[model samples]
Target: METVKEFAGMAAGTLFFILLTWALTSSYLEEYDLTSAKPATASVAAKVGTKSLLRPPAFFVKIRQDDGSPSEELHRISRSQMEKLSIGDPVSGYATGPTGFSTIRTIVYDSIFYMIGIFIFGFISLCCLFATILSIPAIDQAEQRSSHKRAVKKKRERRKKKKKPKRTRSGWGLALGCVAFFLLVTLPFLSNLVHSALPAGKNSAEALIINEDSYVTYRKHEDSSYRFNIVFDDEDGETILAIKDVTPNTYRNYSIGDSLPIEYQTSNPYNIHVRGTTLTDIQQMLLTWEMFLYAALFAVSGFVIWAYVNSRKNGRRDSRKGDRFASR
Candidate 1:
């Protein structure tokens, strides 16, 4: 009766996992199809205007008709597309909708991130399914052992052994060590992987250097350290403010009211990058491949360690059984 209950619980858990995986997969497929659709080319003549001042700021285009009259409808745009436009610059791209209300799809709005979600859920579901299947044999073996009185006595004897406690502690220690190692090695790569997937600064624009300052920190028996910072704002009257750390030479080179060439991330205007600092397409591809390689190595190393530890434990158990039989 207990075994039946255990099986039922496992079935329920496996079904839940499978359902979650299916939902995520379906959503991902739908998004993939939307993004894969061929975009239409259309001439867009509109004046750019800010729609919202929120984070990940939104913009809209006041469409101008061919007869020089403004259309009633406004088309929304992303930050990357908006950055290149002044209050009234012509916007043109592969449009995603009808002529007067077309939107240009940019990297910020892509569905690539859904791939990561689907992959994670699918992996979890597969692991749950395999675990449930493997546990059936273990449950049967446990039931058979429980039916024998001598097996119960032997189990009690094994539990009382001091070596069993030490072995368990060692196993737990190894597991913790492996987990720590895996996180230490993979966390940086994972961070880079996610960052690479997101939209970065693509267009360069000059920001007015509003202020510059230097601070000094003195240490005992050491020369005072100087930190230079500059504050800048973009030209769109959008009030994009960013403070950047600069070297002594760079700080001295630019003064207040100077135009500083800079690039800011589309998703976050405050996260500024120096001009020409963004990764190229090939470099981004290499970074993704490197992350995958590190993940594969960690998985292989963990499997090898687990297999070695299990073999050692099995050998010890077999030697103990042989000693008991010889004595009898």
Candidate 2:
């Protein structure tokens, strides 16, 4: 019984740490657009025609759109642009969108991510570390308790039956179990609520699919999903091509050479979301929440098992009592 408790605590702690980390990091990235641009050095290494593993330099530029909406796109500059540019210099480029050219824009290099990365990653790491420290003593106490309970149980079986203390609901174990059960049962609804509450992207664009790619996921067996290589023009008639994953249903619904609607937040264009799909920051949070919620359910399962063992012990005592009455 104690073994079960120890396993439950450790399992819950591990899952909580993992899920919390993912939720925090993902939210942080989406909120700040940390990965929209790459190092200027990476852009230099990238080739124009090939899919270079090197990242693009991060830059923020106000796109000269025909509508004059004062919108800006965050992205990395090309190799040639980086060579000609210096700090504080305005680099010119064409702003691209889904179907047609948006406008010409001037971009500048920015490298202030070191501090942001330190703060976000540091906070997540500390949370995991503290959780680990707390689990050690919990495991030990559970093990000791299990040993004593088993010993007492064996002694009771050999001796004559006595009236046991009435079971009560005031114990911490029962309370914790109830809380865990509540969380487990309501988890799906909570996730759905959070997803619905997340704000939709204000900016919309139409992207033309150039090609498609597929990958397998372990959800409900080997589920397949698709991604698209899309091409769209900016404000200056320059084409921007990128790959983005679509939902499984959406992937199957569309084919190569098809055009689909995409939307993104005003703060970060690269944080794109396909229309009518569940893919968003909230969805990522829900996935992480799911892992922790399942762990919570398992933690409570330990209590269920412990209760079953105690009930069996009580049943044995009652059987002995019936036998004595019958003999008399």
Candidate 3:
């Protein structure tokens, strides 16, 4: 019966940890625009209100003449040939019709869905946290029960009194400190909580990529990322510079002079994102710190249960030895 209880406690702890992790991940993905698997369906033109690239079943390309007019000449081009076009050279986008969701709509709807996800994940996390907290005392009680059984066994046999385990003042202080520290670190707020309170903004402009500044990093290996400076011109002829970071994958999707669909706050134009980019990069940094805290909690929960079970087994073994001595 004791073994069964121990097994159940361990199983519950494991399951709780797994659920907590999944909930956290789901909340993160939902908060950002990372849930889509389909490619962007927005039409790509060099500038808004300009003539769209001609669509044909067969691939074709157009070049700008020295006079800045579209050349009458057309070239049959393959995908590889398209890749070879020089910067400032005009080209056409994919011929397929629009299909993917708009970046602005996705961001607006994502914020609403993110709130719902946070509530669900937050509720589950709270329940599991309480269960974990209750398990600690239950484990301590199990140890006390094992100790009491051994003490009663000795009393029945007329043996010398055994000394009880003594916990020193420092031990009590250390235990209380650990409990306080655990609570402080595991309290979730840095990732999902911060995002939930962020001021919601709808991006209403299409940003034209004017320039790109690339840099190489050696964080994990040789890799590159880019910071793009884009210009957003409003209907009143006011132009704003919006800077965006592009990962290697996102950088491949665009080039200089390509117009990117984006959403930004009117109050803060610097806070902008390209349609293809998700806003997970910032949350990811916060997650790295919280990951260690949760990992420690999971390990401590399992360890406490294991220690309780081991203590019970040890007590039974000692009680059996007492019985053999009494018989002799």
Winning candidate number (lDDT): 1
TM-scores, one per candidate: 0.31, 0.30, 0.28
* Candidate 1 least-lDDT 10 residues: 48-57
Candidate 2, residues 1-328, lDDT tens digits: the string is 7656765676676666566667666765454453443322111111112121111122233333346443334335454453354433444333232322211222222323434554665675676566555456665677577677877888878653542333333454576567676776656545434433467534667878888888776675333446776666534444445566555567777888898786543443443456665455335433443445555665676666677578668888999999999999
Which regions of candidate 2 deviate over 4 angstroms?
1-201, 217-223, 233-240, 278-328
Choose the strongest candidate by TM-score.
Answer: 1
Worst lDDT 10-window in candidate 3: 48-57
Residues 51-113 of candidate 1 have per-residue lDDT tens digits of 111112245555566676766555666656656755446665444334423455432345446
Candidate 1: stretches off by over 4 Å: 27-32, 39-123, 138-328
**In candidate 3, what are the lDDT values of residues 133-228, reduced to their tens digit?**
545656657767767776687685654333233333355456556656665655443332332335574455788888877787666533344666
| Residue 308 displacement in candidate 1 (angstroms) | 34
What's the C-alpha lDDT at position 51 in model 2? 23
In angstroms, give how far residue 190 of model 2 lies from its true place. Answer: 11
User: Which regions of candidate 3 are displaced past 4 Å?
Assistant: 1-200, 218-223, 233-238, 277-328
In terms of lDDT, model 1 sits at: 0.56
Candidate with more favorable, higher TM-score: 2 or 3 = 2
Which whole-number lDDT from 0 to 100 does residue 65 have in model 2?
Answer: 38
